[model samples]
Target: MDNVEVPDYFICPISLQIMKDPVTAATGITYDRESIEHWLLMRHNTICPVTKQPLPRDSGLTPNHNLLRLIQSWRRSTGNSPGAAAQMDKRKTQETSLNQSHIDKLIRGIGNPDSQLKSLQKLEALAIENEPRRKQLVEFGVHNAALHFIMQCHRGKNTNASGLPEALHVLYLIRNSSNGLKLSQMEDVIGEIIEAFSWVLGCDGETLNKTHAIFAMKMVVRKAKSAQLRMLKPEFFQKLVDYVKQRGNKQGINAALQVMLDSSPWGRNRIMLVEAGAPFELIELELKSPEKKTTELILGILFHLCSCADGRAQFLSHAAGVAMVSRRILKVSPAADDRAMLILSLISKFSGTNGVLLEMLRVGAAAKLCLVIQSNRESHLKDKAREILRTHSNAWKASPECLNLPTLTSDDVC
Candidate 1:
């Protein structure tokens, strides 16, 4: 690791030599700001600035305290540096310039009546000796960078060229973008990636596919406030919520429940649990969350609602609403002692009015619970499930209402 003995295969692509710059490559990857991610994806201290090679991303140069000062200097030179957002209006004429490649594409685009990608290719090739144009191209392209990465994961004969890690880089960008900031009004791109999950992982795609999609979606949801992803447009949030609530495999719920409590803002906290159905009042309460009993309280609220005619109505109407409550009762809190109690509460709530309990009971939910309890490894659960079965069965003993539910079984339970 000494200055003289640089790592092998770690050459900078830009310079085609030892790396140098804010950070240099220490591994085989040579992508830099020009070719690397706009977010300074690499940060190793020394290497051929040109080659952009590196040992590995994990071991790359760590940011030093002076990183702020370096950032300031970069801003000064760029004029339109990020913090200079306020001053952009003053330099409208002199504002951010377009790269030569983009300009070239625009000019050549007039006559090139052939393929659209060929036009883009001509544009991509404008990298040579066109510094200003390159900068513009980079900035403009940043808007859709996440999209291109996602498209790389789609089904096709050419998919092998679209590596999984490369696909993950798109996800990494989505998850780690500053303040969880995401592009604005961009549903088509995000939708394509999510909808194709089953294709990406093949037949086994359902579990892993939902896991990754939920992870990124939650991160974006957590960071949003007063702003939905610009790219997702105004209604896109609802669409994303529906994606998980209905299309998601069972695993999506597990991932949604795993976000750390403290890091979550109240709005996100509420939305995280209730999906998009989180009301403004609920979100406010979630701000003071983590009071030791918050989870229980939320569960209590959920129980009172789950079996009610209105609650079921809400669930049936809103996909997110269904996911929010079901995740707590079934996926996340299943093993908790109170889970069965919550289900019982719901069952009782619907006892006189609606039809959930009757439907479930008719479907042999009583027998199903008994079987689950009997087979459960935890004796406590066995007892709890058995008690619930008994309670449900006996509830009808006193001239009980008949269940109109169609028959369901253990297979459907799974």
Candidate 2:
């Protein structure tokens, strides 16, 4: 069997193994059932591995019975022994059996100053290998150990500690696993973890470390109670804002935006973020025309920030803020359109000075609102766009740009 040449097409693109249960994706690529399921479901990936086409999480997998039969026939013709299959099963059983004790040992090693780095590397590798391993790590409270290690490094001023990044990566994997890490019951522990993340974000570690740090921080912020979120230090927000302004890695930027959005529901946190100059940085970030999801996140946060007078002042302070929000209408996803419209609605209602309203016309924002009214967006969103146009139509309708738009009506101005 080892020397036999297997058909290249018989191998799974993900696991690179003989196709045991071959299934075809919508993209017309065949992969092993387990491998593709893990890729789509466990890893939460949306792109087909072979075709790089959009593969939704709920996309059906059609079983390739003919290919399965061919592979089985090929295996039988190659005289693949039953003993080899038994050995493979035994190895898998051994791996499953060793996980608990192995994780226990690693957790103990994380406490030891000398073996911390090596232990973290092993744990990180295990966590990355598969979802089950990550769930096991979370079950064994490895996230706690990882957090403890990070806090220790923070206290010891060990910014350069090799284990710090590995520990952060491990924590992120566990937190992001299908069976997410359970929230720590102790408020103090949660606070300490938040502090540890703050230090990691501000530290001069590798960019990868800060990236993982922000990802983990996002999860923490999401799980944190309102009181806990409100308790966040000013420096925490400053660090996140600085990361945004500096434009860290793409994932890091999104995570930071999510963190801000999650915390923005609390008025105090909103004020803190606005005070940190988040509005300016977010507008600057948006002006660069980020990806769809990133744009949604940025617009979502801006929508929240715009709720307050100070936030609105900060958002309106940017010359392109209103224009950017207007441009995203009907151009990005439905979510982006929703948030952008909400932002425009807020500015027009609360801060609609003649100058601001006229600027909205000058920047084509009024024209965009008219487009939204005619767009195939959700009825509620279309209604929202119509309302914005009606509320400010007197100012917008007089403009030649808006006058030419067929959707603009006398009733649009209230």
Candidate 3:
């Protein structure tokens, strides 16, 4: 890293102005960490200005002390456009009442560093002459601005809205686009949400994804909690998978997948996530864009499904699908034993009765399992494969044709 040249664009958005105390000109944003800290280590602050919520940070990047933070940092290496979320806090009644500092403090007070939320009763009392300020506070708030402020930095800051606007028009585009395009949007949203949760709210991705806020927006709704927000899920998921296929971007893919896994619970907003065409779609996609990791993910999903009696039955019931999957595993031959163990787990799920077990044997799956025990070098995998082998060994002992075949070892009685 010492030898690595830090590009000029790597300059902090706050520091581009060359101020000793650089601040986000557009969002009036500042972090507990700053530019130099960010340059030294990427971990600083990803907090939202209005919510005082710190954004979630991923383990993939290093920690920085002085950087403006990813929210301020990741907006661009060069920097944010600064106008989309920009607003005028102009005074009305033909005269201004307070200075910008007062206004900034008041707005920040809504999500004060300590605890900014004013009581609703207090808010109602304050609204006698200053109702517009309350509306202003709400508009400037990060929870309300989660999608808007984040998206505004990219576009539509100039678009009119007294408060957070419906972003479904853009979200619909994000949802309907191909897996590739939707992923790009998901990246932006993930980064923004991370920034919101970690920097603004100071929670990790694990917490944010699991929170009621996320669920309120994404899961558990007659029509997804927040329809626009819901549009992003499948797109985000599909994109992580796409990254693995197109670039072999292991680090990137894993980081993206981490977001999905964190966001694991079906927001219940839509079924597109857990039951989207993803698992089935992946089989075809992976054949062309095979990545060891994506294969592992697919295998993990199948393993999860196969673990339950009902799930296993359903998984096996899709005989055509199972056949395709078995062939895919064959294609991944010389695959790690862990992968073989994963396959063996799936195999173990099925009833080893004549039909299914014989079908597995006929499809060349049994031969493959036998080969796994004979050939695997990984100890953990080998041990599990041996356990599975014991199951098959019983079958071999029961059938004369298998009994006549080569023995696993001389110690075995014929």
Candidate 4:
């Protein structure tokens, strides 16, 4: 890197990395597309990184075609080809050599300070270009190797620090790319992986590194055996909740949400999440425009959290909690609707104060329940919705609006 005399204009202000797909923002400054998008869209920043100018939240990024061509020409002139170009193309795929001996040698070489950097660069290049390479790396125990590599950094071993980031990147890419990868194979190190991720979350690192840590944590937590999931500590859950509150990146937030969902199946995990203030944060997240799966997982966590009184109270503490759940019933997906119903059921059955019931009515929670019953979708969910309405019918029935609306079914035993 010291040998390279790249032009100052070529670096992204946020990541300080060479601009691959350069884009010009409304602020008249250029940035790498991925880096700027992470800043604006993922981190929800409203200011341009370089100019410090206020950017409209929805401002569009214009591609810097001229800068891109110049960068490409420079790379070609520098003979950095093939390697730099391959690394830039995230979607590029390649066939792995599948040489077990070669893989073993790379893993062993990672212990050497000087060689570790070169090995990690090579591995990261291989891991990013294709699924086959990632699969092969996992097959050759790169998962454990990469985890150990990060652990070495934590342990103050491998004093040469050049490749630790790349090693982590490769680890995240391997787990994310390969479907057959399993955490069961590394059960002994699950705690170490969690510890490493907690360290990453707390440390001031590159945004991508923190993002990778959250993704890796999600994968490890999701794939751990049932017993292992139940054994996770509150500190781990607290770290995840902190990540959610930090709102560092969208991918990281979604990963944290997934980790909570995967871990929430355990009763204690739900309490931990609730105690971590996950419900309020999740409700706030829902108010933002999240991807479909993100919304579903958030709702799923809320459903589990609502199972307990503390969770229900925390969820209801959010001003938009009831309204947000009502709005998502028919708008998102079937899975979301199912979970949202359970959340409402828990609140109505246990915490239905007069104010809560009135708030539900005002927020269209009552209307949503009626729609659920009329639609006859997901019979179990419909049944629960009916129970909520009927159980509170005396309160609802007193309302002239409720009286003017549809009549109660025979199931309104209350």
Candidate 5:
């Protein structure tokens, strides 16, 4: 069967295998019945894989009997029968279950120091192979085991442990299967997980290990409760800030930024981030013109941090901070614009010292606010921008940056 030159059209695009029961989707692309059904029903993907057009779950799939007959005839010509193919499929399923059993054995051995690294390597390989196996691993509670292993490594100061990276990678691959409610219920476990992430971030381990650590941490933090978030140590925020400063990997930097953003809703975490010099690092990162999503995450964290006096001061202390926020207005994304506006609003309302207001004018922030008022951004954002301009009109109204904009008038200000 492996030596047979099967027709290309007889292959399922989703599974990249020979189609046994070909079915034609509404988009006119034929796929194996099992593969297309799993894609549309199980995976819930609404788009046709081949045509990139809408293929609604409820859409009808007509049986392609002609293609199926041709496929069966071709198989018969190759000395294979439909019964043989069924037997092969049964054998494959048995093999998959056997692999699962092997994975279960490895997961159980993850706690044994002697077999830990080898077990983690095998589990990581299985989790990387396909999504179904990853789901199976999650169902087997591999995430719990991974978290426990990470805590163990942190406790032993095993920064150089060969298993740490594999463990972290396995957790990251199966992160989407995390049960948020279950995690939120386990406050103590959440705390230890956060601590483990902090240890990994602070350790002088390989860059790949740190990257996976942050990625896994980002997932955990996203699912953590507010109570869990409030209990986070200052060192956690400091390590994350340091990770962001390192800028080791693009995805890692983005994950670190997301973790800070997710944890910044609490006032204590906000202060901790500011104390860790987050504002300085964020401004520097933004100045480098990061990707749009990274910029949005950075601004989102800045907006939250700037809600405090120290955070605002820390933000203003960076020469490029205010200017960078202003530059991002109406430039990056609507999310970025929203956060940039909120950050500016915090500065103008809470930390509006004379020097800061003048600097706002100097960096064309006031003009950006005027532009926001006139831009086609959301009404709420425009209103916030107008209010900022109006509140600081006395300082900005006379400046050429503000005066040159026809939208800025005495009536626009109190």
Candidate 6:
């Protein structure tokens, strides 16, 4: 093996080692998949390493099957026999078993105060390391054990404990990995998980830990049944909105917005979030978020918030409320169009005042409604848009422009 000189073509450009899983980029350059993912996803590079061509963050990597087969053939021809390969594979399994044994010892020590933190640290490393180990951890019931550890932390109010941070981080990684089994309310641990998240969000901690806390709750809420979601208290909603207002990190904000959406199915959660100043934060986020998906999320949450009286009040209270909703109507995707219209419909039907009508007209809300009716839109959306326009036609007619605009009838709206 030492006498064999590896071909330069078999080496990864970035890693300078034999490629394990070679993947070709959009720029037609080959690289090791793990190395390229680290460069593009973790390091946040927008260009190919070798070609320097623009590579989208979400672009797929094509497996270099030909190169992989060639590498395998070369290895087999170079005195790498079946028996040797089998022995190497057996050794690898033994090594993995030894590693898992050490991890299991640490897991058992988690109950001991002196070594608990160190154990949790090792578990976190294993959980976060790579895909195979994560799957192994799941198979070993680490997720369940971590939940118990988290519950202990929650009950003890040891939010600042070193072990709890690692436990939360591990739980988050497990929740995200596709290989991990789904958690449910039937397990009777949902409440404990929520409490753990609340502690992390409300208490002071490292930014990374807090970020993981927000994402963990997001995953928890996304997976929880409607009954479990309804069981969440107002404080839960309040903390989520407060985290959004705090705007700790970009990923955390995204997770908070998603959690808000997930929890919005329960009517009380909507009001609680409104009370927590979610509408204001959402409006601010909408104004700031230029991404289509993020803007749609903000608008979707805003639509739910606007359904309730308190939510509508909070939404309208924002100076750019009507204007921002109006601005997104035709500019973004059709889904955005739907959400924006629903929000405007709520305000126009229940919260519309003369001043509000004039504000709508001045902010081009009236014009957007006209565009919705005139454009190729769904029948219901057109009806709502026309209803909005006709309901305020008399007041809007005060503006000469509104007077000259085609007068749409109730029948037309219907």
TM-scores, each model vs. reference: 0.32, 0.78, 0.38, 0.73, 0.76, 0.76
Task: Judge candidate 1 at residue 34 and give its lDDT.
Answer: 43
Poorly placed runs, candidate 6 (over 4 Å): 1-103, 184-186, 400-414
Task: State the lDDT of candidate 6 residue by residue for 230-255, as single tens digits.
Answer: 78887888888777777567778888
- CA shift of 91, model 6, Å: 8.9
- Per-candidate Cα lDDT values, in order, are 0.39, 0.80, 0.39, 0.77, 0.80, 0.77
Q: Tens digit of lDDT per residue, candidate 1, span 206-310?
A: 344445545655554454443333223323333333433443443353334332232223334333434445222222332333222444444444443344444
* Candidate number achieving the greatest TM-score relative to the actual structure: 2
The lowest-lDDT stretch of 10 consecutive residues in candidate 5 is 177-186
Candidate 5: tens digits of C-alpha lDDT, residues 211-304: 8889888888887888889899989989988888886778789888888888998898888889999999998887774789899999999999
lDDT of 3 by residue, 46-137 (tens): 43323434444442233333553433554544343333112111113212133445444544543332433232212222222233433433
**Model 6, residue 29: displacement in angstroms?**
27
The Cα error of candidate 5 at residue 163, in Å, is: 1.8
Q: Which candidate is the best by lDDT?
A: 2
From the highest TM-score down, the ranking of the candidates is 2, 5, 6, 4, 3, 1
Tens-digit lDDT string for candidate 2 (137-214): 787888878877887887887888867867887877787776567766545677678888888888885777787888
Q: Tens digit of lDDT per residue, candidate 4, span 1-414?
A: 224455668767655567889999988999899877765643222656556567886779999999999988887776764555445333223223467898888888888876987677666655654466678888788878788888877666433357767776777778765575566667887877787777777676676777788888887877677887777787888888888877777777888888888889878988888888899999887787566888999999999899999999998889999999998997889999998898898899899998898888878888888888878588887788878887898887776656444645455423
Instruction: Show the lowest summed lDDT stretch of 10 residues, model 4.
Output: 88-97
Candidate 4 at 140: error in angstroms? Answer: 1.7
Please identify model 4 stretches exceeding 4 Å from their true place. Answer: 1-95, 156-161, 176-178, 182-185, 400-414
Candidate 3 deviant stretches above 4 angstroms: 1-144, 147-288, 319-336, 396-414
Model 2 TM-score, all chains together: 0.78
Candidate 6, position 200, lDDT: 76
Candidate 6 to truth, TM: 0.76
**Model 5 clash number:** 0
Q: After superposing candidate 1, which stretches have Cα over 4 Å from the reference?
A: 1-240, 243-309, 314-341, 349-357, 376-380, 395-414
lDDT of 5: 0.80
